[model samples]
Target: MSGIYIHIPFCKQACHYCDFHFSTNLKKKEEMVLALAKEIEMRKSEFQDEIVQTIYFGGGTPSILQIADLRFLIDEVYLNYKVVENPEITVEANPDDLTENRIIELSKNKVNRLSIGIQSFFEDDLKMMNRAHNVEEAKKCLEIATQYFDNISIDLIYGVPEMSNEKWLQDIETALSFDVPHISSYALTVEPKTALHSFIQKGIIPQPDDEVAQEHFHILVDKLSENGFIHYELSNFGKENYFSKNNSSYWLGKKYIGIGPSAHSYDGKNRGWNVSNNSLYIKSIQENKLPIEIEILTKTDRYNEYIMTGLRTIWGVSLERIEQEFGKTYLDYLNQQAAKFIEDHLLFVDDNILRTTKKGKFLSDGIASDLFLLNLE
Candidate 1:
């Protein structure tokens, strides 16, 4: 089944390290919401024959919108698309927005899941990241949210400069104490043009060490694994039956439509994305034009994507399927390229599936790039 992703482009404030397409201005939020709904309706024919199994509201912060606004967008999806019964609807929220009444409202709505952005439960980390919420809001939101929702996921960041392994452990422990069913954690990378990068360049803040991030990842894996969490994806750990259906669909290369500026869509053969400029996107959609661009994936593009996603998840690259889909020639190239990593014990082929070893998990993306077929076979 396919899924629908709605991107909200407005934020209360900018995070220091983020470079994602968003605006801190609130003046256009109401108009933007309408444009998003219109885009949803406009793209119905793209998935006219498919059934939607998940509806994900992601953004600068989806919870910034009122529950009524969220419901209106969701209802538009239901009104236009052929949605499955009991679709998994997810909203990416921040702690500051999850008030007691907000949690109650969200729990009673079609939103069945929340991916809270509690990047760290420490005042210093919060300040460094410029997260709108504080440490107390992080813990308090989880306490109240857990009471209302069972399918909850929280975000954490690792390898912040000056954050020791012990401090990282405490962060994980605090999250564990709340018994969140899923967690998505990532290394604190400095993207060019972001405040974090500028800080590092100016010697205001030290760069996040890759070695420290690797150490933190292993700690995360071991701790969560011991607590009955499955390392379902590279950065995602979920308890049984709690894996993110919305995100899992993307890794598996299923069809999905993304609504709003800077959102992306992918079918098996082609990928599309909306304009990154919010005003342009809204204006185009309002004029009944889709402000998007599409590219047809080459065979090489598809194969490379499969390798990148395959190595990062529990489901490894299927050798037989590779041969079946892209032919034995591409399969042969993959086998030849993977031999060195396999010999290094960083990757292995088991029962026709190629998977990364625990040692190689942190470097899966790098390894996948090595396995990528640059010239068409």
Candidate 2:
């Protein structure tokens, strides 16, 4: 089963730490929405009759769009794709947009899940991040949204400077109190060219400390585990059966198509990405062409991808599968590379499955990078 992802590239305001492709200007709202709907229709044949089991609306805050606009996009999908009978449709939303009327309208559409962006519960943290929503809106919106949607996942940010341990605990406690089904918490990183990067460079804001971030991560694991929330993914916690199907598929290396400016697509062999510029994307589509870039994955690229994604999840990389897919030579190389990590207790190797230890999870990216194999051109 394949998945479809729609990107909405507009936001009310830019978050200081975010580097995702988006525009804060509302001048082209209607044009972008209409173009997005057109893009969906245009890309219908890309998946080629594969049963679409999941559809996701991720963005610059998908909840910012009007209900009618969303309905039009959903209708277009239904008209074009052979979507599954019980497909999981998700929309990424912001706290300020989840009004009672809005929630009611969203429930009426095909959206069965909401990934609310509630980065933090502290007013100062919100202000520091230049988020559009306040602490009260962040707290109240989830409660109101629960009336209409049960498959809700909320986002939280950690590692922000001045985000006290007590405050972080309170944030998690508040989210837990709301009984949200799923939570995606991430550490804040200063990406280059972002406002946060500039602020830190100019000493306008304090930089996040590595030790503090590590401490917060441990705190998150302890509290969520005590509260019966499974740490399914490193950044995601879920209660009951509320894990995100769309995101899970991606991590598992399933095929998916992404539509809209700056969106990405992967087919287990090749990856494609739309042009990041909105006007160029729309104009190209208007002229009957897809303004996108494509890259064909080589053997080593595929193997390294498997190592990176598979090692991070509960499903570890399987030696037998690697030998079967890539060859014994590649498997031998992996075994040789992983020897030191296993010896250091950072990786656990048992029953042909290789997974990161709790300690290794913190340095997963670095470990994965070290394990990457470069293809000689």
Report the poorest 10 consecutive residues by lDDT, candidate 2: 368-377
Q: How far is candidate 1 from the true structure (C-alpha RMSD, Å)?
A: 0.7
> Which ranges in model 2 have alpha carbons more than 4 Å from their true place?
none
Off by over 4 Å in 1: none
lDDT of each: 0.95, 0.88
Model 1 per-residue lDDT tens digits across residues 300-343: 99999999999999998999989999999999999999999999
lDDT of 2: 0.88
Each candidate: RMSD? 0.7, 1.2
* Candidate no. 1 TM-score: 0.99
lDDT of 1: 0.95
Task: Please give, for residues 1-377, the per-residue lDDT of candidate 2 as tens digits.
Answer: 88989999999999999999998887878988878878888888787758889999998878889989888888888888898998999999998998888888899888999999999888889999999999889878888898889899999999989888998999889889988889899999999999999999999999999889988998998998898888777788888788888988988899998989999999999999999988998888888788889999998989998998887777878999999999988888888899999999889987999899988887777788888888633
TM-score of each: 0.99, 0.98
Candidate 1: which pairs clash? Answer: none
